[model samples]
Target chain A: DAGITQSPRHKVTETGTPVTLRCHQTENHRYMYWYRQDPGHGLRLIHYSYGVKDTDKGEVSDGYSVSRSKTEDFLLTLESATSSQTSVYFCAISESKRLVGEQFFGPGTRLTVL
Target chain B: AQTVTQSQPEMSVQEAETVTLSCTYDTSESNYYLFWYKQPPSRQMILVIRQEAYKQQNATENRFSVNFQKAAKSFSLKISDSQLGDTAMYFCAFGRGTGNQFYFGTGTSLTVIP
Candidate 1:
């Protein structure tokens, strides 16, 4: 297991409120990814950072945003929380960008919006 | 959908028995990678097996093996001598050639009954 950790393992926020989930990694991985897990959707990529300050949108990046100011931290923020945005968010890291699916995932953060 | 498809939503196997989970994807690219990730009740995503598209041989680790068919775009996971601890949700993922993003299937839930 890579030294990856997600903060606020569980969170509850009201609709229209701002929320942020933090993912921290101790390993010096170059690529980091954010994903959301749902019942029927499995896991959908939200955003990913290939290097410091280099981020890209995913298939489900409409309502979310991410920032990677440094190599070890990736922050996912929901500008305004919505009910449909409630899901388990996961952070993953890979040693190289070419090995996209070969990643180590964090414990995951469960967020709920009322 | 270029997304990976997992036909089995749930399955059960007797302890020590063998079980196979199905996965299919749509892609025209020849160089890529396939991965199977296991998520247990602890909500931890663990990488089970990985197969590179260029490899003709299947990938295996201990009791976990993959049956990868490039022409058919099918990648299935086979578990041998299944144990109680094998109960978990399995996800199939597809990453394109040198791409930074991946597509995941909904996932298949496997339960090994003792």
Candidate 2:
């Protein structure tokens, strides 16, 4: 929980539509991450932001994009929602990248694309 | 890129019994961190324990302890006196202290029975 909140906890969208999930944190953590959880896959990183305006791709970044305009907010965008993108998304924040990988996660956002 | 592997897909344990979940990772970096996270039915990620690669001793938290073998790249979680609340999906993750990304395993579903 750690002061992280994801907007629209649950959403159902049609294929080809665009979807944006927002993550806000009051911890002022410098590192933020977006991850997707599926039935068989534990959690796959979609994207992460090390600082404002600096983001990088993760293991499963094919159909995802991310942006961080402020220290407290990070956004994940799906240009065209696909059925394969339907899953529970998690937003996590960490105090530092040079520390013990201690990350605090939000409640999570459940998105279903049909 | 580091990859985490959770070999057990599902497991069951009786109340007050002990259980172990196995995890392995492929990473060339010498300085990294390992973590075990639990996700209950509520869909919240709870950090159970963590271990640093440089530390030879295993990390423990109450009834939750880890058996970390750095040479074999294995990090396993052993839960003693398992309770009903321990039923959840557990994930193993690996991250370089300096990297912003974390690699998670497919997960192991644990069921604790009365």
Candidate 3:
């Protein structure tokens, strides 16, 4: 266990509705990452944070935003959810940006946008 | 940009048998890392094993092992004595020692039949 938890493990919302997913960790790790898993595409990075208030976009960042104001919490928000945006979101944490060690993952959140 | 590829979309093995999942990647960096992750029906991503590109020796974790062919940019996972619990989706990932992003391959769904 990496001491990670994702809230609202399952959700269903209509298109154009704003949605937020929360990832909380107790490990006090320095780096946190958000990824979306979809069939035929594996997992794609959405965003990542190296430190509190420090963030960057990943391969697939369109229509998504992230916030990390504290060491233990990273939040992902969909400004306007779309059917195409439905996916299983995962949160991962590492001790450093280099990731010399393996990353620890949280149980994923499944979101469905109609 | 780096990319990882898992050519097998699905694989099956009888209990107590061994199974190998193939993964290939494209990268110009000589120093990096490779990982195999397992996601069960519960939707939790669990690290099965990891290998550093600089290490000539393969990495092993209990029943899980990796055949890391650095020259060929291939990282294949070998699961020995497969069990019913091993049924899951397996993903291969690549990361540089100094970078924050992890490039993932489309997963292979593995079934361990009794």
Count clashes in each candidate, considering only residues at least 3 apart in sequence or on different chains. 0, 0, 0
| Model 1: CA > 4 A from native | A99-101
Better of 1 and 2 by DockQ: 2
Cα displacement (Å) at residue B37, model 3:
0.5
Chain A vs native chain A, TM-score per candidate: 0.96, 0.97, 0.97
Poorly placed runs, candidate 2 (over 4 Å)? none
lDDT of 1 by residue, A1-114 (tens): 789999999999999999999999999888899999999999999998889999999889998989999999999999999999989999988876565458899999999999
Measured on C-alpha atoms, candidate 3 has an lDDT of 0.93
Question: Model 1's CAPRI class?
Answer: medium
What is the per-residue lDDT of model 2 for residues B33-109, given as tens digits with 9 covering 90 to 100? 99999999999999999898999999999999999999999999999999999999999999787875788999999
lDDT of 3 by residue, A13-101 (tens): 99999999999999999989999999999999999998999999999999999999999999999999999999999999998665467
For model 2, residues A1-114, the per-residue Cα lDDT tens digits are 489999989999999999999999999999999999998888988999999999999878998999999999999999999999999999999976577568899999999999
What does DockQ come to for candidate 1?
A: 0.74
lDDT of 1 by residue, B1-114 (tens): 377999999999999999999999998777789999999999999989999999999999999999999989999999999999999999999887675577899999999999
